[model samples]
Target: MTAVAHTSFVIERDFLASPARVFRGWSELALKQRWTDCHSDLAGRTHTLDFRPGGSETVTMRFPQGGTCVVRFHYFDIVPDRRIVYGYAMELDGRAGSVSLVTVEFAPTPAGTRMVFTEQAALLEEGQDLAERIEGTREGFDRLARELEPAPARP
Candidate 1:
């Protein structure tokens, strides 16, 4: 059998919240659904997250065109308030699809938490190029940074 080759992308973002808060946002299903999964034009989509080793996260995104894609992540390790390591895959109607490794690290900062995310993925039959996928992933993280920001206080 041929082995799955991988490509990676790294992103760093600073949040104006405490490490614990940021970690909670990353781990908690409710907070994650707020900034994630619910964005973009995908309506009526929902996500379920089980934030622990051997736990799993599933997101089903529905397009306006009546198409749907489901993505799943199986957690391998979780370090409280610090890091998460997981394996991910995408499927259409429960069929085998792309696979990847995802790692997120959180570090305490004077302002708040410094969050870093890295994803290494293998293109399955879909055959997406590494560079294009990495660029798109970076954009997704950029959007997440904006989504996570709290509203500015009025003068």
Candidate 2:
């Protein structure tokens, strides 16, 4: 028999950059590639982003041990530098693994941008790595913090 699990998580992060900058980190394909891969062990194969309502984003990666995972996201709403809501799905070696509703919101704070990321996921039999998933997501945010830092002054 097939099994399914449900989980929802919220992660908050503070970035020392403007809300626009923080939003750009997620909205721009190139910038997003710099920090979105929480699983360093996975080799990214392709990434495409369309940052607008009715658009979609997709990424394909190869797991170190074997197999491939593809992530698909369909944009449902976008509010410039403030918020984004999307539907997410994941496939492993062409088999459906999970589906989720994801929302990310950004707000300006004295320190900089305060971002909240929320994901509600339904995990199919092949997507039972909830703990690992959360850890990877948290690590991705840590990488985002580093990516948001201003470039070093040119020599």
Candidate 3:
């Protein structure tokens, strides 16, 4: 027998940067690494991203205790500096963990840009960590904010 669950959530953030800058954070490999998991303890991690419509991305993370997490994403639609839609599936140590559809929308705001992230997921066995998942997703956006911060003026 297997346990399955469905959930969805939305996370929104405002960055002190332009929509183009914010969009590049996800589109560019180096920029994406600064905010994503290049800094994690995922040994032998492999990541590849193709940012155009119909393109795909794959990210693998290894856990210290046990199990490996691999996420594969396929882009369905992309509107530069506006919106992106993708569907992704996760495998945990060879076991299917979840599948999700994600949409990110960017809008010009007085402060700079407002990004809205929505994820609808179908979670599988041993994958009932919804709270942690939401927190991790939020943390990624936080890292993006830090990544986009302006450097201090040199003396």
Candidate 4:
């Protein structure tokens, strides 16, 4: 029988943008796609996001070395620019891997916004690398910083 390993983690970041702007990064399909899987090395990727309660988001990535990783997020609750709760999971090479319940809360800060991300996950047998997951998320947030930048002036 395969064993299941469970883990939980919280990641927080301060962005120099309003809560609405930060929420837009996750709620807009095209914008979300820009920062979603930026941390991964991929040969190709396709993303779809419905961005509403009961809707689902999916990202399929093909690796250069020959493997496919599919990630899915099912939105359960959304509070506009305040919070979002979702179910997250991963499938790699046809094998179901980790399943997670994720909650993201956004609050106004003195400078801009503080975003807190909390995730509780159940990893399938041969436990997924928790560090990799955390590091990958950190990297994604780094890329998201670009999303917070002010738009360049257009001539």
Of the pair 1 and 4, which is ahead by TM-score? 4
Winning model by TM-score: 3
Q: How many angstroms is residue 75 displaced in model 3 relative to the true structure, after the best TM-score fit?
A: 0.1
Q: Candidate 1 residues 1-155, lDDT tens each?
A: 44566667787878877777777776887767766654478756878888889999999987886767788989999998899899988875566567889899999998888989888877664555677666666665565666567889999
> For model 3, what is the error of residue 117's alpha carbon versus the real structure, in angstroms, after optimal superposition?
0.2
lDDT of candidate 2 over 47-149, digit per residue (tens): 9998899999999999778899999999999999999999999998999999999999999999999999999999986538889888889999898999999
For 42-104, candidate 4 gives per-residue lDDT tens digits of: 899999889899999999999999999899999999999999999988999989999999999
Sorted by TM-score, highest first, which candidate order results?
Answer: 3, 4, 2, 1
Clashes of each: 0, 0, 0, 0
Cα lDDT of candidate 2 equals: 0.91
In model 1, which regions exceed 4 Å deviation? 1-5, 93-95, 127-132
**Candidate 3 residues 1-155, lDDT tens each?**
67679899999899999999999998999889778874466566778999899999999887777778899999999999999999999998898889999999999998899999999999986637999889998888889999999899999
Q: lDDT values of the candidates? A: 0.77, 0.91, 0.90, 0.90
Per-candidate TM equals: 0.79, 0.91, 0.94, 0.92
With candidate 1 superimposed using the best TM-score fit, by how many Å does residue 59's alpha carbon deviate from the native?
0.8
TM-score of 3: 0.94
Candidate 1, residue 31: the lDDT equals 69
Error at 128, model 4, angstroms: 1.7
Compared with the true structure, model 4 gives a TM-score of: 0.92
